[model samples]
Target: MTPTLSEVTVGDELPALTVPVTRADLVRYAGASGDFNPIHWNERFATEVGLPDVIAHGMLTMALAGRIVTEWAGDPGAVARYSVRFTRPVVVPDDGVGTEITVTGKVAAINEDGTVKVTITAKAADQAVLGGAQAHVRLP
Candidate 1:
């Protein structure tokens, strides 16, 4: 359901979302995105390049983070703008457990124009991976 503008407050927090990223997910993303960077899949290459392990694509992480706002708005088209800075790589290991990314959002502001600003924080292993992330959305 779309959250009515009147039902939201500056400090209101959206539901938290946790997503697991596996090696298979990374491979699929690479194929679909045509981002054949070895660092995203080749563990040896990644380690040699100074990465902890295979890393997820930045866009993939951003999309997962944006999903919270789109879902809360009940319409993907409701998003007006979104921006984020990649603060760290989401290192994905070969283990079956992989890594989990957690996303949380808080209502930052309600605009006079029927829009809202949402501040987003995305973390992995209790460490922030996205910084200065925010989303602008239209509410019902």
Candidate 2:
């Protein structure tokens, strides 16, 4: 169920989420997004670019972080605005297991317009992938 405005408050933390990002997932995302960047799929190119390995797309990491709030609000449309800065890359090795991303969210402020400002932290392999991540969400 969607959370009511009154039920939310500053410092209220949403449930944490974890998602595994695989090479196949990157390929699919590239196909859907028309971002056939070599660094995302080519290990040699990524290495040449100084990246540890093939990395997940920044937008993918942002979307995964947003999922933590959307799931808590129980409605995708409830999110009014979302933004994040790419800080680190999420390395996805060729191993089938892939890399895991962890997202944690908290209510940062309650807005006068029945919306809440949520602060989000996203990490992969103990390194932050997104910086200054926050979402503005409308409540019921």
Candidate 3:
């Protein structure tokens, strides 16, 4: 059964999601989104631009977070609102340590319409990468 608003509390935590960031993944994302920013695909350009390495697109990371919320809600349309801030860059290394995304949510406020505003914190490799990830979800 899906979780109802009343069943969740202020400190409830969402399940974590781990995604391996690879050069190929970044390339595919760039192609799919039509965002061919050199810093995301070209190592030399990324370095010239003062980045540690080719970084994953911010939207790619946001999509991963959306996946976590969708999986928990069991319905993508159930998410009334979703947003996040990219606090850090996700670097794809040649050796591929692989990044893991963990998200936890707290019930911030419940609306009169039976929707709950959830404040989410998403982390990668134990580092907080996305903060203030908020989502308004319909109660089951």
Candidate 4:
């Protein structure tokens, strides 16, 4: 069930989510998103371009973070507005266990229209990956 307007508070926090990013995951995302940027799949090319390693797509990271909001809202369509800035590249290594991105959200404000503003924080390797992440969600 979705959270009701009365059950939400300004500082209420959503459960944190951690998503793993691997080279294979990036490859699949590249195929689906048509974003075959060399930096996302080609390590040599990425290194030449000054990237520490092959990195996950910015949109992929954003989608993972957005999942938290959608899940908490209990309906994907409940997200009325969402935005974020790609602050850092999520370095995905080619190993058994790749790096993980963590997403956490807090209810920032409750709007008059029954929509709540959710402030999001996404991090990878203990550093912020997305900046100014926010989502507006309508409650049941």
Q: How many residue-pair clashes does candidate 2 contain?
A: 0
Best by lDDT: 4
Evaluate candidate 4 by giving its C-alpha RMSD to the native, one decimal. 0.8
| Global Cα lDDT for candidate 1 | 0.93
N/CA/C clash count, model 4: 0
**How well does candidate 3 score on lDDT at residue 123?**
74
Pairs in clash, predicted candidate 3: none
Model 2 regions more than 4 Å off: none
lDDT, model 3, position 18: 66
Candidate 2: residue 129 lDDT (0-100)? 90
lDDT of 1 by residue, 49-127 (tens): 8988889999999998899898889999999999999999998989998999999999999988889999999999899
lDDT of 3 by residue, 1-140 (tens): 56877687766666766667788888898989999999988899999989988888999988877776677778889999899988988776656664556666667787888887877776766787787788889978
Output the lDDT of residue 48, model 2: 96
TM-scores for all predictions: 0.97, 0.97, 0.87, 0.97
Over the full model, what C-alpha lDDT does candidate 3 score relative to the true structure? Answer: 0.79
lDDT tens digits, residue span 1-140, model 2:
56789988799999899999999999999999999999999999999989999999888888888999999989999899999999999999998999999999999999888789999999999989999999999888
